[model samples]
Target: MDEIFHVAQTRLYCRGIYNEWNPMITTPPGLYFLAVLFGFCGYERYLNSLILPFCFAGLCRLRRFILISTKGKLKKEIDQFRDVRLSALAICFLPVLLNNSFLYYTDLLSLTAFIWGISFNSSLISSIFLALAVLTRQTNIVWPALNCLAISLNLLKQFLFNQISFKQLFFKTFKFIYQFLLVFAFMCFLVWNNGSIVLGDKTAHKPAIHLPQLFYFVGFTAASSMPLFISYFFQNYKKIFNRFSLISMLFISLFAFLSVNCCTLAHPYLLADNRHFTFYLWQRFFQRHWIAKYLAIPFYTFSAIFMFKMTSEIPNKLKAFYLVFTSLCLIPAFLLEFRYFIIPFALWRLSLDYQSRKAQFFEILINLMVSSFVLYLFLNRPFKWPSDPERWQRFMW
Candidate 1:
């Protein structure tokens, strides 16, 4: 769906018309620049095909980072290099990303940049990749911002725990974390010139206080990670009630209720673009009836609880940073696009240590199954718009 605009923009870039801009395109021209550099210049399909290796390489880096960071916490069987390779291969098949990889979309490269930004051992290189990520998609600025916040907070934590002296903390804090500054300066320029985060299609992409976007994000992720959720439940079902107090449940339910009732949004594109799967989802489920949103509160609450449970093994400070980073990424978008969930989902999935190979296998299998189904529908189930019968539309993530 978005490839048409992206292809045209890149064709202009291929023609050396770098000054041209597409008002319908919201992201920066970094993706098109990469296309030109890769010699896929005017050919969208070739560009998509060429990006797969980079995506795979980024996923491997991500797996290594996760393994090293959580060394002793993982099962011996699951920590092998073979398992690492397998997991990276499986993650490459993630439904949303795998579907987009065959199309001329910026999401794959944007995700690759984000992955390498967090996973690289050298901070300088990581920062540069993060800067490129922000250039590709402005929303990606949140990751570098989160990194800076996390570094500062970690230093404070070390000082509080007497793991580092005040002088050490001071020196660390003063160290050059130029990515945040660079991104901040670039954002200021954008705001000064364009007057908004969105460079074009401003009306459609304007920021909103869509609180329920968090719920949609959580719910979608929960549904995607169903295997993990199911396995976690079965393993802990006996103690689940004890761990979850009535007051906590009540509070979560109340928060979910308020988020849905007060801030549920329906973007115009979400309603009008039947070519996207979200349109059918919204029509058939979320907006089916007045009580539908209310009915969804329990699912949201459950999803949020399980997500917290899954990440409970991470350091408390890092967990807090994770939540804040995820909130910053998801809570502002007025649309319910699954594409926005890709990076956050990748981070969450890689952070986890799957207790059983069975669960891991099921997760991979589920992703493959869904990707195949989506691809089939997208290719074979074309439909025509009533107003434009000559044009064919297909459902996609």
Candidate 2:
């Protein structure tokens, strides 16, 4: 039975290849060539095809030089060595590991690259991974763009605040731009060589210009602006309500939630094809479509409460007012379609706390876990409760 299933799977993949048209290629040559080398071994080929290379790249980029020493037993030493940064890295890797290790999906490759890009502070690497992500699946385009944009904006803000000089900022910005361009060009070249203009033959889809997408952007901007907004508010007001920093953090949290929800609403689709909007609409309206929509409320609620707590200056009444106003403005699209808003809302909230190492670490860990788990459950079938004894035992053991 297993042999028959294997043969059938091979034939299916072969058929997919034979019917391939312009830009309909399965994956980049880097992945394809690897796939071909291991093709004779069936499933092993799929595993080796992307996983090996991804693992290699990931290990190559691991910053072993930052290690700290401790006098303790191996386990104790290792535990202590896993600082917040390492913890953050582990959190980032967990989702990709789960996806690739269990499901054999290539999506994790790009995600890994994205994580590496951020971890190593390598724009070029990030761009390359993002391009691969788009090639693997187009819906991933927003992430690379948003990530780059956020970094750029943060640097710009630092320069404006005299945290960094204009000259230094300019050079850094230029380097990032150059790296992005180079990676993008290489990806395009690879696509062209693979007989595909874009990543896959799949038709590209886009979201309809709707209130939801708009509100998502608004939420994103508000969240991103939280620090500045809070700072501005506090400077103007003599006394802090709850705390100036916390107020700023709230905006960011709201933004992150809204952003994720926005993306969820749109359904991540490639840019080349024209059918993305259809996918977005279908997912948005389908009540039981994905776990992301269902989990959004709790995620956003947590973020909202956290933000409220972070602010020290705003009186409960004012906080209530702020929350109400912000929610009202942001809720329209999110309430109508929740997934499209959650991520951005969370990211926005996160940005406010980025200045604090502890806060930033927590933000990254929570967001990564939440996003990854939701995606994993949604993609898998025969949904079972996590508390099921067998599943829980397997996970724990």
Candidate 3:
């Protein structure tokens, strides 16, 4: 953050700020411009710290919007209470969000723009926020457009089902294409102004077809958000396996086999260095051990199932959109990074439109338990996380 603020303070050229003379940056210049807006104060980090307040404010607003968006799906009484309940459970319990906000990273702002962009009703207004979302983080381009993609997909479905005339479909498509073109124009300008997409050492972000990194990301995300609908998984496991023809198990086996034989795709400097909370414990006992990696694949496989099955009860349009969007979000990544899962996680938490009342109730209960447990753990225990490897050992990779 200080580096970002310093870059903004010293120079205005986006690419130059990240060139060999300065710190490496993989994102667009929106964050630097934002830091400029905050103004140079007592210290660069101090100015950065002020963003946390705005971050939480945006989060509260997002929660309000999410609640309002889903209000119509529930009964009048439940509508009044459900959003607040779900909001508390999902937001308060999420350690990643809390940590990200606490660290005053640019993610909160990007996330704010993303939720606002998707939830806003007006097309022009939504486009503006969506544009802002992409500027905040390059990866956000797809997130803000998810609703549009879903709508577009739904339109195609309508056409396929003979509910909409060919002319109507074409007209809507043409209209949307122009709107998207405007957004794309702005993005191109920003990227050109920033000089490059991967602003840091280009090799750092070179795309790879590694599946293990993606597998880990999927598994971790599923585990983190499992309390949302885990009861359904437990109650219908047998049916799910039978109906799905052991497809879930097959995916599990595939990833497990890959984990042991294939290389682990993880970042050395990602989130407090390479060894984070969960991976730290895994590494302590099973460092470089293929068995541990293989064993962890099943857990990830369950998570993948949970995530894929989240919107099963919702409209197939939404399900298809999510499937495509989630894959697009992960496929290009060279290594595992939890931030990549943020958008899908947000969408997953908001997928309550077509859920049963009982499912909603249990989900709320699970959230409460999880939130309470997280709070309890934080309040009552001493956190003993491992420090970074001494002087960045080569083996750390």
Candidate 4:
């Protein structure tokens, strides 16, 4: 609310187009517009309640899409839709989604647009929803990127089968990306206007690698999602070192560098106080070589294994794209927050089997418990939990 009120009072595109309290114009105007709408309704909280129903509505549409996509592959036609839809709902209620829905955050808005984008069959509709998603949260460009890759691959397949010509595929690709040009232009405009795309006063947000935090993210994210695919990882150990995994390895290595340079992070609570530790590890550690080798590499490699095994059930063509997409979402951030892992976990959890009621039930229960812990952290966590930031930076993650 602090940032919202600060931005709300200002006329956009006016003279001195930056808020000293929360400058940089990092976030596009979507969330601010929604905040102003709810502010008029005069509610202190529970505004997410109004948006919650729409999120569920998006899930319903997404569930139908999932079922339709998985059709005839499953054995029984009669029970397939029910089971698939249940699994979709199960994923939808995971603590991350539940928690985000209660807060006045952009996660739900971006998620709604994302789910609806994937649900729609038309390229135009999908592009619009994805464009809105990017507007809501700048990092959401990955959604459109993944979509463009999928469409291009499909067009290639069509051309190979003689269903479409080379010229036709080229034009289609151009048109698809062009439809999203407005959204991209708006992002460029924000960066152009902000003068420094880095949010807030530059002094408040230093950049650092902090490989230890990346280690924490991979381990926590993997455990939170569960070990359902651990066996497959071992069984296909040799085959797992494919092109996609190689690319993923290089991507993680690249992430460490980009994050250190402040190139990869997006809206780490841009409008809020810069309370988060950015160059935290550098402030304390003289050396973190042990961490990069033993911690960062192992956790990141295992995450790739888990990602490969979990995504095996999905069609092969898009598997590599989703793996890259998932990695792109989490790795750029300065903070190692639980909320950062939600997007990847939510999408992968959809593949869980609803037939095993006990398994599904337990999964939801575990996630809910984690959600409870996160809620506790949000509500009651002490500011002095690690009062000495520089001294305790290693343990911060």
Best by TM-score: 1
TM-score winner between 1 and 3, please give it: 1
Which 10 consecutive residues of model 1 have the lowest summed lDDT? 74-83
lDDT tens readout by residue for model 4, 217-327: 555556655534454455567877889777777786566544433432333443232333323433233134424433345455667556655555468655666667766
Q: Per-prediction TM-score, please?
A: 0.91, 0.41, 0.69, 0.65
Where does candidate 2 have its weakest 10-residue lDDT segment? Answer: 63-72
- From the highest lDDT down, the ranking of the candidates is 1, 3, 4, 2
Per-residue error at 275 for model 3, in Å? 7.2
Query: What are the Cα lDDT values of the candidates?
Result: 0.80, 0.42, 0.58, 0.56
Candidate 2 residue lDDT tens string, 1-397: 0123323334444445534333434344333333444563355335535564554345323322122211122234333343323433433333323433344444445444443544455566666655654554433444554445666888989998999998999887776784556446655665765633344443442223233343333433334334434544445444434465456556755655565555544333322222222344345543445554434443343334444444443345534543443443343332233223332332233223212334334444654665466454445523335455453111100
TM-score for predicted model 3 compared with the true structure: 0.69
Q: What pairs collide in candidate 3?
A: none
User: In candidate 3, what residue range of length 10 has the lowest lDDT sum?
Assistant: 388-397
Q: Please give, for residues 242-307, the per-residue lDDT of candidate 1 as tens digits.
A: 645456677889988888888889999999999888999999987889998899888888788777
Which lDDT value does model 1 have at 350?
Answer: 71
Off by over 4 Å in 1: 73-77, 81-83, 150-174, 243-246
lDDT of 4: 0.56
Candidate with the larger lDDT of 1 and 4: 1
RMSD of 4: 7.2
How many clashing residue pairs appear in each of the predictions shown? 0, 52, 0, 0
Task: Give the poorly placed runs of model 4, Cα more than 4 Å off.
Answer: 1-21, 37-41, 71-86, 149-178, 182-187, 190-217, 227-303, 351-355, 377-397
